[model samples]
Target chain A: MNVKVIVRGKAKGAVLCAQKPVNFLGGIDKKTGLVRDEKHDLFGKFIGNKILVFPNGVGSSVGAYTIYSLKYNQSAPLAIVCLKADITTASGCAISDIPLVVAEKKDYESLKNGQEILVDAIEGKIL
Target chain B: MELTKEEESALDGKHGETLALAYRILVAIGEATNADKLIPVEWAHLSGVNYNTIGDAGEEFLSHLSKDAKFRIKTTVNPMGFDSDNVSKFHLDEEFVTKQQSIRNSYVKMGATPSFSCIPYEIFELPKNGTQVSFAESNAAIYANSISALKTNKESAFSALASALTGKSPHSDLRDEENRKPNLTIRMKTEPADEITYGLLGYFAGKEAGSSVAISGTKGLDRRSCKSLCAGMGTSGSCGMFTLGEEEGEKIDFDYKEMARVKDELNTSESGDIITLGSPQLGLEEISDLVAKLKGRSFRKQCMIFCPRAIQGQIRNLGYDKELTRAGGEILYDCCTCLTPLVDKENIDAVVTNSVKGAYYLKTSNGVDVNLKSLHQIVEEETK
Candidate 1:
């Protein structure tokens, strides 16, 4: 099911990914390629292959750098979609060089885990 | 990717060493954040107090800046790494103990203040809002700045502090036309009807609605994945563990494993029944009061009290560590008291807390009947 999603926040657009499960709402310390928080659900797992989903983000300043590190290590996520597209995500996306998109209310919660994400951050859709 | 003349001057070590370090760090952070220019910052709530987290980076950085020492700006910093006492808790593993202590020693050897309370603002006043403040804070501090005080805090404290010390930070906030817009509107729940403490009320209000903690608004309230090993509870200052009346129930729900882990830590050893968390932020007044209360009560020795590291150091400075050590004063850190702290939960029955989050979590996490009294009242009832 290729669903086109639109989100209304700071930055809204579409990319090549759509409604992928937002596995965790934290970071994957791009430098070490390890999930930094010992308490997260996906604590030790790598974010290399998953279609990572989240609202904006919260936690360490190491966040943006971690994204860059992930990209450098060839473990970056396929795409990113944020509910609140703010500086934090913007900076992270700019560095990791990952495909970016924003979510529309029409596709926000409806994008369940395990779905493929085809997004256009500029178009603000997931098709 | 671009630097202004002022930024380049700091980067090229034009301003003194402290500012230079601040610039270097903030430049890295800004680049990480994809900002092309810097913003002005004066007051910053810097974290790096804890070791490990802010330990190595802080020690190395500060050691260099403060080394052949002098003053760039007489500034205050609230570091995130370990303070002295955090290094000495849960000595179950000597190796872990040694590592923690060494790192702590390194941080302190420099000029960093070991004022290990989450609420630096409570202890010392910060600059006012629209005051062009810069700060480095995580969860609670970020919320306090963005919502409680409506100030501007960067992603983390390190970023904020670096910017503040150097006089420049991210060019992305407030100035960027496209990014200046806002979203997410979280409503703190409690009314000011004397129904709850202001702090506790806000926490509960957010929790009751399963509020998502945000930079400004409320959209990210989802709690589908809070089971990470580090369940962080923010502090306003150094508070006792039994402090309560906050609203975490709506925000978090413990799983079966978490529940068990929660149950396990409530148990304390009854070696001589005179258990006490080591000192620094001593509830001495509370202790005096508690002793008075228990003058004629039973189980006088079956008492426990939480003492902070600052108080412990004071005791050591006063030549009393050996005496206090002999008096059965054990030590604990505030962070480890969360959902399940790998302690014996069954043996303990009473608790005393100064931190609203601590008291509330203990009561909510366990069926333990705890008290949200002042440091004095806690000592009084328990010691008495």
Candidate 2:
């Protein structure tokens, strides 16, 4: 499917789709890459090395630095796919050099947790 | 998106690794927002200073970037975790102090002014109206776009830092005149009587409006009320700017019910262990007004007032600081109520505050209950 490339990279991994918007700063554990927010649907699940999928980011601008920290801590997702890209997600992916792409509504809805996928952000495509 | 030769060269690392990263950030945002190009910015007011807000990862990132990056335009910064002078008085953690200092040093090394204020529009002289600047502090961005007649999208910490380094921002969103019009009109059914009420109105409007909004039935808002509105609007959602008068759009009513709903969410406690004021740090005029209100009266409980250090200096000169001190009000500078280390859950069960932004963060970020009251109500009830 076609996508909007945010950061240029290629990655293949199983998906961890979050139904709600993620707040990186407090919603995820930087050290463990686990969804720590109890309110989040993906609670207790790992994000590391997976293709993380969510609608977009919410909350503090510090979420950008949290994403950077996740990469530094060696717990970053292999790639990220979102429906709408807000400033928090865009800048975080940019600074961390994470593979990021924006999918259309239909494509986003089709994504399922644990589904194996290839994200070629460099080519702006999902396979 | 299009880039100038210089921008391309910088992006390609000719300007060093830091500049390349800065350009990369701008390019990514410009692309995501569908901007045709970047435009020059005159100033940048940045956030992400508080250690509590950004933590260790942010500190390391800033330290690495500050090694080579220098701001190209005028830049101001946000508040740190605690008041440096009153660290011992508050008994803030030693590790927190060291980390917070490192963050401060990083910004200073990057050639950013040590303003340590969220309300940069009040402390510094503004550029001419219609000028473009980058402001990451949410309240300041909204105030600039709506009240000061300047142009800016509500920037994030990284984007504002990128703008400070590159002296340019992506030309999109509120930066474009066409996007600045209100998409929704919020008609006030009940007149807002005070800053807190105006703040509630702003909070309700932000949730209901789109990118921009038109707020009718409110006029001649003083600086305090205006700042409160900006702060409340900024805290609730991503909505950036609001026009004061009615504009053609889908209309919604901000009646008594809406006001009560917002207040119900923020005000969680009947009474509080202490009283706190200032979210967007108080300006000189606010301090003067506060002093006038506290004439010959003392707070029944501990009252903490946060203001910019520059304003503190002016108030000190005018003896207002002395008078406030005499009235049992502890004046803290270079910090505000939101995310401050001073108001810990271990130290205080709940806080009484007149700021909507303050009440929200105090409860969620600081982990304490909030007793919300108008400034006038606080003065009348808390003083003896």
TM-score of 1: 0.50
lDDT string, candidate 2, A42-99, tens digits: 9998899999999877655667877887888889999999887777778888998998
Query: Model 1: residues >4 Å from true position, as ranges?
Result: A1-48, A58-79, A85-127, B1-5, B8-38, B48-111, B125-132, B138-150, B170-200, B206-384
Q: Name the candidate that leads on lDDT.
A: 2
Off by over 4 Å in 2: A23-49
What does candidate 1's lDDT look like per residue over B155-253, in tens digits? Answer: 454455454345556764433444323322223332221211233333332222211232212222321101010013222111101111232222333
Clashing pairs in 2: none
TM-score, candidate number 2? 0.95
What does the lDDT read for residue B369 in candidate 1?
40
Interface RMSD of 2: 1.8
DockQ-based CAPRI category assigned to the predicted complex of candidate 2: medium
